[model samples]
Target: MDDLRRIDLNLLLTLHALLAEQHVTRAARRLHKSQPAISHALAQLREIFKDPLLTRRGAAMALTPRAQDLQRPLEAALNQLTSLLREGAFDPHQAIRHFRVAMSDYAAHLVLPTLVKRLRDQAPGIDIAVCQASREAMLAQLGDGEIDMALGVFPDTPSNIWVETLFQEHFISVADKRSLPLRGKLSLAQWLARPHVLVATRPDADNEIDSALAAQGLHRHIALVLPHWSASTKVLTDTDLILTVASRTLDPVLHGQELMQFTPPFKLPRFPFQQAWHIRRDSDPAHHWFRSTVMDCSRTSPQSGEKQAVSR
Candidate 1:
């Protein structure tokens, strides 16, 4: 530490230029400094390192053995310092960065398609890795920096985390047309009578649908409970099981499927589908761009009664 304090960093840059150019005049030109200034800097570098870093060999200047040893390491150190100083500038188009995100298949269905398409066209070198975890695990992973961000409904976020609503989504009840043959609006009695497929991230999760049903002193039978919403539409194709999921979850998977989507019999309040990250990443330029892109993509498929994006 004392040695580092004694050495001038600016002189090191001069030393690097001198070592590269191997001539005082050329080194000065490279650094846009006068020849005498570079020579003075070289003299100071020699005194600090206790070695003649550059020596005149015949008609041109050459590097000493010590200078040759310092060349690669000094260049690497300066490159790292340059990157550290420019950390605020994130060029998405040229950056080859990998981001890990935690989200449910439902959020993936809503955001991934447009996100991937945009990434392919705008930032070809960037990659996104998506993972699924329970809400508790997602929070923990965000805190531990295991994932860059998470997308879902985060109702009880911690003080150390930040939440931004990508969009507001409401429930859309779907059923196999061949089996239930339902249309626009499902009756409460008919909805309660059919077996349902419940998509819950955690086994003990009490979803809004169940809460709405419990409020009316009625409960539907859940014949199957799955963790992923990707296959939820396909699961209802040949069965009598009906599912009430976020409208966006069914958007991509409902094409050419024998399914009927209708309004839920009971009113389920629209929830904010959100993206969360550690508060530490709140001001990161790249993360800001990413979350903004996500919000924009989410707006592409706006829900009827949904609210606009809200950042908190």
Candidate 2:
């Protein structure tokens, strides 16, 4: 208890950096402190814990058994303390933060360009890393802190996640204007008969579009299964293959291409595009700022007039 009284909060931060980096030089670099200061802290830490927390192995430093035992609990405690300290307010302009966002290629195409531009203007010091992943992978990434937020449709949300609907979009059939006799529309039979390009990030999981068709005892001829939304454009442009994509996703991809958008004859459920985050970050100021910024960007994005009719 007396040792606890002698401890400074900064020592825990140094210990965290040291344990994470496993080298005094690296820890000092991470803490933005002089190497001697880090060594001094390590010395103090050794005195407090009555153990050489780190021991040199050849040229590298390694955590001792006692230090290894403290790693996880120390990291978790530090994270909790950091979160508590950050609850007051967020200043976007001055804060330097790295935000990791998991999004589909389609969402990145439609949303990230504008979101990045807005973030650059509003929060110059903040950096964003966009990762492409399936919804399941994204949820796992969120839980593990690999991603800060996820942007896409999540039909069934778990209770532990927090979701905010950004916008609603619906599917539109896109085909080469010249290759197919598509005059802005296709019948149910025509739509089903055409060879389609399906975008499925995970091949094993059934896409919502396919599931909806299966419910109605109908299925389209999916001649090509691509992992990305952008890949469908080349197939649609070069062949008679039709691709059904979200209206917002289609709008951006169709630019400079001969693709023509038409409403599907069969009714499909509208996509509720949302931003999801772990419930742990629901009240974090930086995360709140990020979510708010994304929401603002999604709301102000220019709508495609052609797809306006399909949006509900």
TM-score of each: 0.65, 0.67
- lDDT digits (tens) for residues 164-213 of candidate 2: 77877888888888866646677899888889888878666668788989
TM-score top scorer: 2
lDDT of 2 at 218: 98
Off by over 4 Å in 2: 1-88, 251-257, 301-312
Candidate 1 regions exceeding 4 Å error are 1-88, 181-185, 251-257, 301-312
Give the lDDT of residue 261 in candidate 2. 76
Model 2, residue pairs in steric clash: none
